[model samples]
Target: MKKYVQEATDINVWTSLKEDTFDRGKDIREFIEGLELIEGNAFISLDAKWGDGKTFFVRQIEETLKYFRAKQMETEEKLLKDLESYEYLKESVAVKETTVEHIYLPVYYNAWMYDDHNDPLMSLLLVMTKQCGGAYNTKINTKSLGERLLAVASSLPISIKKINPATIIKDLQEGKMDILSAVKTEEDIKECVRDVFNDIIVEEAEKLVVFIDELDRCKPSFAIEMLERIKHYFDDERIIFVVSLNKEQLIHTISNYYGSEFDATRYLNRFFDVSINLPEISWYQKQKVQCTNSERFWITLIADELSDYYGFSLRDKLIYKSSIESLPRDVGDAFSQDKMYLNIFEVIIVLLDMVDAKEKKAFLEGKSNILIDLMPRIEIYKKYILRSFGIDIRDDCEEKLTEKYKLVQEVYEYVFGRDTEEYFKEADISRNLKEICIKACNGLKS
Candidate 1:
């Protein structure tokens, strides 16, 4: 019944990195460690396809940076003693090792969650004020921050509640005051906002790293506005913005906002100083080295093999795994027992139905060239056959492997072919195998 992958919590991030579960932890830590060389304000874009673990990756980076910040503070004995009271910090091996050299106050913001706000800049400022203030235990001057925001609000052409521009014009016309003197220019407003940001960073850490996630998921106008606001107002030496998104989706969003003819790539280039693609997961390599006879291991191996065959994204693989896991206990046991090939085909049919019903229909209608084409190409079935029959591929002849494949293909045709009942009656395959395959397929559908 699990519908979605869990969001990365602090403990999840720490544990995953500690275990190197996805095998990218050392690279992630090294990437954060390299951030120490950045000298000024930077806008870094971490690009990945949707559901390619961008959120998790960025969260790990944020946690790693926080660990570095704590380590930096621990250089002072009093601060070290204070940090000892935080049990979470004690759990991080990175903190104990001091893997990163620089300290950056990190703030994570979900842009999609805040897209409903009136202003992206205001929402971002509030997040910075809260996250940085709470993390470092630094007392922010809320009154001063509020006053600065109000100052910017008042000078703008937009209306604020109860502020009458007509009254100001009347006063100016009556020679009561100079309207120009009261008005703040664009540069003045930018400086005011910059000073507010500086106030938050100066007392907390040497630099502020704001990790903006889900930007591509927001409304196009809001996403563009966020980029513009960062470029204009946050041009300071002590701030870094790490925006994570799918660049292709963001480009589509831009095209939706601006006309399709607009140069979104060039426009996007103006916002980011550097861009990095999330590293791909090495599923095949990992699977080859995995040594386990557990049901989950085989299930994961099947999912990984099929995922590569179909070119599934990380998210797709997760959903496929979940689908397999949702099957009955007996169905899973069938995979680990005799006739695993039949059980695997049932799983494949279910996956085809889930991912491409038209293809599944085509496959069931006896136009199984698609599935047949895959039989010789996939190594999982070959490995399974070899393991199940106690035959080593290294010592076996090519003709024998071909005969085994022919036998599998014959079973496939008899079970899933058009007029399957006729073929089922004629084939020598066990009635129990047919019953199990049918029951599994029906169970998964239900």
Candidate 2:
């Protein structure tokens, strides 16, 4: 089955946000831009549950800042040349112009990817240097910074052998250094690190916005150490750190590192200056209506309804859509009456198998109430299913709605209940419908 993959590239991020699928991108971008008003070093946290698209949201903000930064440079020709591979941005840049005055240099670092390194500080510095090099087209001098890092690493309570010399100090790989005398004290090392950051800001952009993502996915020690490193070493007036993570998971990681009785939430609060929860997807929010004939439209609708009931993440919704797409084309025919309920069942079965296989197994094993209990109470899904049975719910009258729901329940019983086979035979319930659904569900599980 096709999996959901988010490409970490500027053009892909632009394309995804240009469509503004969630409709909250513009507002969130404006909020991020407002961070420029905050003086001194600011630490902001973008909190979301795992797989809820925190990474995508932050990347969208990153791209927006980069676009405006490019605009500030007045190098439209060079920008266009850089984006030559993505022709969509040629017109996009013109249409989506912002009047924001303050734009900071943005750097995205995936903390989980580099957590295996000896020091979070070293990993962070390397990323900042590399990204700055690409943005400014000039190599940054990290010799002094590298020596000081070695001194700091040596002084740190952690093992010095864990430090990867090749990655951090490429120029000093063959050179020898007395780590003891490189820096006098902790204050001296902090000052040197601050100077390095200042040099980067001076050479590249006036201000820096560093986005640290996936910290929660890192090891407990690594995650805690990263936060501590950021709080101590990278403090600067021209720098703003935006860290994206599932705060709950990070709290658990903290509790794991400390004791289970430790107050992880209170401890985590010390690291962030400001925290914002990533917006949850709301069904009531006005979304662009899809064409009724579109297969994707139906699949998305079904998955969305299930998501509301099951708390499926953005990733879960994508996976559910993919599972539905993997079925036989004949089984997916929307226009065929014989396949209408089958298509809906296929969508439901795929999701049920994903989230609650035990419940699905019980339903397949002659327990009709298992499926009935799991059915979503949303009006749109109910209306669509009822429409198949030639029942149109035109009014919101309580008695009529109740009667309609009972009809839906009876339809479920007729399709899934083994005992109702003889009773619903006159209603033209397909004899092979249950058998086909069971076979499909088993095939998916296997």
Candidate 3:
């Protein structure tokens, strides 16, 4: 029998602390604290490019809110107990409210993960219904909401099985069932659902904080529906929604929906109370020396060599590094030499916008001839691709792609001599190269 243990640094937002190197987590917590200080429903957006870890940041926000809520609940409980004991000791009964300020029940809904569903409203309702029965007060009666959800879902045009309401409730929480289509003429349903949702929220907790994540990754229509539904149905004073998305992509999605002539930015303005952009990761931090692993060093070395022309920001350089780092296992150890790393990364960046995943994998992992075969394309990337993008890679002797290529060739020649290509073909350099790259890139960019 084997048991598994959780890794401490496994990218779990709940367990991980805010990285001091980045201010995103701190800013998000401040925003949440601001919301907690006030009353009424609020809509906040966490804006970042796709793959910038918006979900991770949102998870951190969720955990922080939960932590505060738990602490408040404990204080409230203790105060209530002390009050009761005092009343008993004095032989006089007194009544006082036990509710604490800013106690919230958080619901985390990944919108993109439910893209197969046609109804954003149903997806939200399902999650809310289940979350209502969670560790909060048992008197909240989410069971009624769950039954209502099932009834509404069954009334839709799809062919759903005769699921037990009990089973439906269980499955909904576990994400085993999806609530698909809504009945035609959804206004009545929307109002009814909204009423129930608001009632449950008000009765159960001080506020309902729903974090809608990955909206940018959802289908355009689905994403639009999510916003519309939130605005129209879930706009209770005690409800707060935190959405994570790439704002530019969302603007594009809006334009696609309402036509290119639509003033998407103005249109989108009404949906969010606050829009926070996650700052790009810094290449350097003040007062602290950054850690650079071996793999990151290789990527960073090349990126630094080209930064003067490419103008790759820390984020852009890291993104490019990710592409190179994803190269297959077969060519793993063949890219250690500083020159080889630079030359290979240069090629990958140029061809990145062209090659599909499979093609890139094949090209990277193809025998010892990988570098040699890529030699012909070196001139092409430097000439046509780089210059077309207004970049000149051969700025100085230090930045010449030709020199980098020559160094790689020389290294192979020195190591393998007459059988240089064959030696690389036979070489197995496989010591956690990806981990090395991550460490390097995590350090100061230079």
What are the lDDT figures for the candidates, one per model?
0.69, 0.67, 0.55
Which lDDT tens digits does candidate 3 get at residues 243-275?
988899999989998899999998887899888
Instruction: List TM-score per model, in order.
Output: 0.74, 0.74, 0.60
Clashes of 3: 6
lDDT per residue for candidate 1 within 1-446, as digits (tens), equals 45545667767766655655565665575567657778999999999998778988888778778766776666656555665333554454444444655568889999998887667876787778767767776656555555555565555454545545455434333445332233468776677667677668755387889999999999988999999988988888888899999999999999889998999999998899988888877876334323232665554566567776777666666666666666544643343332455546766776797688888887666466555567578887677667655677789455666676666666676656646345354334553454576666665431
Off by over 4 Å in 3: 1-11, 18-25, 75-101, 135-142, 149-164, 167-187, 202-204, 285-300, 303-446
The TM-score of predicted model 2 comes to: 0.74
lDDT of 3 at 38: 59
Let me know the TM-score candidate 1 reaches against the reference structure: 0.74
Q: After superposition, how far is residue 30 of candidate 1 from its true place, in Å?
A: 3.0
Residues 1-446 of candidate 2 have per-residue lDDT tens digits of 55545565766677766666566555555665568578888899999998777887788777767766766775778777764333443334322644456757889999988877766776787788778766664436555455446656555555656666544576332223333234568787687677667656754476789999999999998899889988987778788899999998899889888999999999999999999888886654422221122654554566566665676676666666566655554433223544655656666678768888886666555454643454446655665656655555665545555564565456555677666336463344466666666565444321
Q: Model 3 — TM-score against the truth?
A: 0.60
RMSD, model 3, all Cα superposed? Answer: 11.2
Task: List clashing residue pairs in candidate 1.
Answer: none
